[model samples]
Target: MKIFLTGLGFVGSKLVTHLIQSPENQLRVVSRSPSATLPAGVHFEQVDSLEKVINWPTLIGDSQVVIHTAARVHVMNDSCDDPLEEYRKVNVRGTLALAEAAAAVGVKRFVFVSSIKVNGEETFPETPYKADDVPAPRDPYGISKLEAEQALQALSSSSGMEVVIVRPVLVYGPRVRANFYNMMNWLFKGVPLPLGAINNKRSLVSIYNLVDFIGVCAKHPRAANQTFLISDGQDLSTTELLQKMGRALGVSVRLLPVPVSMLKLTASIVGKSGISQRLCGFLQVDIEKNRRLLDWVPVCSVEEGLARTAQDFLTGRRA
Candidate 1:
């Protein structure tokens, strides 16, 4: 199989590594620069931007699958005047252009890596977001992704190209950045946090599991024209997660018993409401659809995944 992939960031780079392990598969990456640390045999194409019409027909020629992982990811303090329009330019318009080009070139499958935010920011305490749930994207990024999914589905119907959408919750692993990485750093340094009272349950995916599922979707017969919400299937509270991270780092977690209400109030006052919600909110996904339809299971347990992430952090390996 010939695979054309976009992006070389966290998930995409790992997926590229995994795909190249199979000698029968050939990999080509599209990026703005030719400086990616890809395997020797993998092909690389330099493209200015996904939003522009680049010779995609020739670029995607003979490719069986196009895995799209690039996007205008959500920005915490967006500087753009019209954030939604900015996101639409890349996430929606750019994605459709690539999909159309792939379809024109007879690509059989297009796997889109979407986010769980498409379902909503939060879930009910006991109820988890399902794959078929009505989309309620509250943020610009989520709305853009939802629109891209709709456009892709329509393109699939019209062009007879298989489209598979995989929505993954907070993916964490080696070389992770942003808030998760900061949390890991704080934990490693034995910084005391006041999240011991957060009792909300959240779902997260290990990069290993997400890449495995993407590979399955690339070739699985039942995965065609399907949407999947994937996770490790193990939900954890904030306190539990911190405890587990501490264990993985071989350190004793130092969490103060701060009241959840007080924490939220302080966060609101400090303009960190979003951070507070993520730390103390319920956001779990039901991944039964992927498990039942594709017979897919997470390759690593949560404990194992956490240990691996901590080890990578300690060793300074990108992994």
Candidate 2:
């Protein structure tokens, strides 16, 4: 099948590489600038104008599927006064424009890479997030992603496009950044972290697993107009993650047990209660839908993934 993908960033680059090597698929990538250095089989185009680039018949004329991966990711150090508006323009508006373009063309399938943040930050004991869960995005980025989901759903109904949304949590592997880099930096420095006492569970996904799921979504019959929350299916605590990462790095994890209350107080004083809550909270997701519908599970285990990630970090492979 011929597929067109937008955004050749980390996840997009990985997906494009896999698609290019696959004998069954032909891939094209669209970006704001024609600056992506992709593999031999992949094609690239610089699409500065969303409207002109996404005219349905033009964008999906020969393509059977279109995967929209381009978006303004959450910037932790952004200088924008209204980050939400900025996010809305790139995430929400760009998505809507692309969907309209896909609908105008004859594309049969449209896959959207959404975030699990659409369900909210933390999950409760009795109820983990499900596909049917009403979206309750708290932050600007999450809100923009959820808004894009809604807009895409509407387009699916009106445009007869098979829209599939995959919401993956904390995607990690080689060439990651932000919080994952922070964790790696701590490990590289061999710093004693105060996370032993925190037993909060979180769901994480390996990059390979996420890319595989997207491949399934592209053609699976049951994936039409469906939303899927994917993960590695292991809810590990902070300590467990640190320990595993340390093992992957050939080092012993050194965790100092500080009182949870004291840690919370310190975070509050620094106005980082959000960071504190995530560090000391439970956020588990149920991936039963992916298993039940598509019979999909992570092919790469956490141990394998972490080992690869550690090697990649040590080798200094940049995105």
Candidate 3:
């Protein structure tokens, strides 16, 4: 497969690296600014516009597959006046523009990396989000991703391009940042945490597993025109996650059995209600379809993945 990879951020960069390692595959990365740390001997095109794909046909020349993973993801303190519009500009419009260009260039499969938030912010323990669930995006980012998914489906129908959408829950692995990274830091340092009582179930995929699934979708026959919700096939509660993380970090876990109601109340007062929800909410995915349709199971167990991430963090800390 002559694959054209986009984004080159967290997921994209890891996906591209994984795909290119196969001797049977040919991969070319497209980025607005090339990373100096990309694997040696990798071929990538540096351009001025990743969002618009300026001169797209020539830029994407002769590629048979495109794995698009770019987006304006969640921001901490966004300064934008209309966050939804900003998100749409990159996630919806830019994705469609690139998809059309890829179709025009005769690309056969376009795998899009979407988020679990498209289904909603929370799920009941009895009702894990499936790929076919009606989207209930609770935030601007989720809404934009849902819009982009819809647009891609419409484009695929009209242009005869095979579109595979993969919606992954919180992705964590070696070098993961943001909340997962902070979780590690807190656990490793034995920071006082009120998360012990949080019994909410959340699904997380290792970057290894996510990249593996993306590679499968890029070429699997049944994956064409299909959407998949993926995870490690294991769900963890906030308390369990912290405990496991402490073990991985070789630290004794210290947690306060703070009541959920008190946590939410305090967070709301401090304008961090969203943080409370994240720490004490339910979000899980049904990956039965991924297994039944594609015969895909996560390549790495959650324990192994967490161990690797913890190892990397420790190595970095020591260095």
- For all candidates in order, the CA lDDT equals 0.92, 0.85, 0.89
In order of appearance, the predictions have TM-scores of 0.97, 0.94, 0.97
Candidate that beats the other on TM-score, 2 or 3, i.e. the better one: 3
Cα TM-score of candidate 2: 0.94
Predicted candidate 1 versus true structure: per-residue lDDT over 1-319, tens digit per residue: 8999998888988999999999989998887656466798888887788899568899887999999998888898798999999999999999999999999989999999999989999999999999999999999999999999999999999999999999999999988889888988899888999988888999999999999999999999999999999999999999999999999988888999999999999999999999899999999999999889999989989999999999989888344
lDDT string, candidate 2, 244-292, tens digits: 9998887778899997888899999999998898888878889899999
132-178 in candidate 3: lDDT tens per residue? Answer: 98889988999999999999999999999999999999999888898
Error of 2 at 176 (Å): 0.6
Per-candidate clashes, comma-separated: 0, 3, 0
Off by over 4 Å in 3: none
RMSD of each: 1.6, 2.1, 1.3
Q: Candidate 1 vs candidate 2: which has greater TM-score?
A: 1
